[model samples]
Target: MHKKETNLSHSKLANNMMNYINKNIDTDINIDAIAVEYGLSKFHFHRIFKEQIGKNIYETIKSIRLQKASNLLITNKYSTITEIASMCGYSSQTSFIRAFKNRFEQTPTLWRNGGYKEYSNNILHNSISSDVSHTSFSHLEAKIIKTKRKKLYYIRHQGYNKELSKVWQKMMAWVYTNNIENYEQIAIYHDNPIITLQEDCHYIACVKVDDKTKLTNTNLPYFEIEEHLCAAFEVEGIYGDILKFIQWVYHYWLPSSGFETTTFPSFSVFEKNHFLNDDGIFKVIYYVPVRYV
Candidate 1:
């Protein structure tokens, strides 16, 4: 294979590994088993993963697990510390508390009981302006809906900033090149920007695809957006507006709504993409996967 093809192959494998880990986060994940599943020797798989992802496999898994735990701590207040630990795959609450404190510098109980605000405020100080408050979307009503599963061709992006325009540009180029039409543009927010550092947020730029679509030559990965029960809200906003809206959904509306968020990441279906437009405005239907508390 050409050098570019080899790189693409590595990226595809890394994406597969990430998806697998996330889906099975609550279960025991064996690295050797993953290597076997990918038909590669353990050493080879680790090398490829580190080279492409800039972090060793173990580090990636630990980071993802902790991030999931952090999200759960804030979103699922009713679940006890022991339950949250079990949900995040820790063998025991003692072990989970040790790891969580090592990573977050706070115990699970403190993080759940408002310590996260301090952590978030420290990270978001320079990124999000103080004036951008969740009040912007306070009046918007959320509807409960069931969404069908969707197939997406996506490019993973790391940051949630204006630089995302480049990712959207690349996605559009891929769509036009593949002759894909009648597709909806969607973005999956894998991290809560309020809690995660802005530069480290996981964002996916995706285009919804159907059975008829064909990719003659492309290396982009495909992800199936599982069917979800969600609280859907229509939002129209500028750069900071969507961030504020997400904050509102998680902090304001969710706790009192009699629902707990699911482990699935929240996503938005774009009616107009702010990144691609000159005016920097967006129209989207934001979906937060949820279930009754």
Candidate 2:
């Protein structure tokens, strides 16, 4: 197998492990069980997971649990912190508060009452939730739009914050080799990075092709981004700012938008905005699947 093929194979296993963990977050997440399920020795599985995703399994699971706890806190739907902690996999409320305070510099109650926003005005500075911020997307006009299905050839990645630049570089090489460097670029996030550990989130970077384009004789897989009625919000900024923008959209925008979501997950549609001083900024349109209430 070629180098890319090897990466793809490892990527798939890492993704599977994440999927399983997500499905069972409320339970004891056993790495040994994951190793046996994958038919790899525990040692080998641990090493491969770190190599492929750049984070240890324990760290990934902890991150996922913390993110869930924080999101629940922000939603304030749970009646008490104790219940929230248990649902997030902490057996003891005291232990959960200790862990939460250690990570966020605030207790669960404080985070629920907007202390998190004050401390993490900049989302990047926070350690508690992968998806957190007080950043405003008020500048955004997120509204419903219907889109036609798109055909694309894409590459999938699973890992803690997989380097976007590396993804673009390698994808560009493939596109350029195929003589389609000028094609439109798009990305799909199957899991929200804010809610999901960066190492565990799944994403696909795609090169757009017309319906008539043939995928034969190439190993790159092709699929359609299903058409849907969506609430779309576009933001222009550096990468970190883009993440904060997303957090704002989900944390503030969605719950009060008087709309319900559909089956498809939200995704970021990408386009280059400006390139100057060896720096490239981007314009990304984040779309959430929605239906009118």
Candidate 3:
């Protein structure tokens, strides 16, 4: 194979491994099983995954499990703290709570009760705007179309403190396994309007579900999309890097584009077949609600 083809094959392998790990969060997954799934030797898989994803495979599993447990706690009215802890692979309730608190800066109960606050005070949160010199707007073409309302299975992520990688893995895994795979557009909607330029900005990881009525069967949280006017911007390469594009839109695009920003929290849209774009290159479609002032 040519060098580029070899590179693509490796990328595909890495993505497949990620998806497999996500799908089996509830199962007894170890390094050997995961490495073998991708046809890579254990040592090589460990090294490659770490270099590519910036985390070892074991760390990825643990992080994802914790995130799923946290989601189950806040969104499910029927779930108790103990049950949530056990489901996420934690052996003891105290250990679960400690890990949860360390990640979210609030207890599970506080998060469930809505005691956690979204990141506010933009200037305070982002003090280094002067350091970034890329104020020149990327002349992105805008296309407007009315989309039908979508039923979403969503869990509110409370507190601006936890890593969302695990939460994302679990949510996507559930969606992929369930019959709701048809509704493939995934989104993370934040209740907090302010973008603090961090991964922990309080938000909801959501997938369009069959109906809000079936949300109970999946053991996941749920919400429905309300119709609204949205301004969309597509950013290529690593959705985690959306803060910079958001900064550009809020500070530069909105003002010059003759569009007024809404107070509502914007959402990031993940389209199906996005992996096919530029050969599994990551991208994010940021949806900012807009209106004429």
Give the TM-score (vs. native) of candidate 3.
0.47
Work out how many backbone clashes candidate 1 has: 0
How do the residues 1-293 of candidate 2 rate in per-residue lDDT, one tens digit apiece? 99888877777677567656665677777789768988899998988788877888998778767776776665434247887677678889998999898888888888878775665455444433333434456877886899778776777676425265677677777776666534677777655555444556666677786556544335565666668998888777654565566667657776567765432556767767222113656787878776675
Candidate 1 residue lDDT tens string, 1-293:
99988989999998888778777888888999879988999999999988877789888778777887887888887888788777778889999999999999999889888888788777656676423644467778989999998988899888788789999999999888888878999999988887777777889899997778767756789878688999999989788777767777887688778888866889999999988999988899999999886
> How would the candidate models be sorted by TM-score, starting from the highest?
1, 2, 3
Q: What does the lDDT come to for candidate 3? A: 0.57
- For the record, the alpha-carbon RMSD of candidate 3 to the native fold, in angstroms, is 14.6
**Lowest lDDT 10-residue stretch of candidate 3:** 191-200
In model 1, what is the error at residue 74, expressed in angstroms?
1.8
Q: Every model's Cα RMSD, please?
A: 1.7, 6.2, 14.6
Candidate number with greatest TM-score: 1
lDDT of 1 at 102: 95
Candidate 1 C-alpha RMSD relative to the actual structure: 1.7
Off by over 4 Å in 3: 1-137, 158-162, 189-200, 211-216, 272-281
Candidate lDDT scores, in order, read: 0.84, 0.67, 0.57
| True-vs-predicted CA distance for residue 137, candidate 3, Å | 5.3
Candidate 2 regions off by >4 Å?
Answer: 1-8, 19-30, 75-98, 122-139, 144-163, 176-184, 188-230, 237-241, 254-266, 271-281, 288-293
- Model 1 off-target regions past 4 Å? 128-135
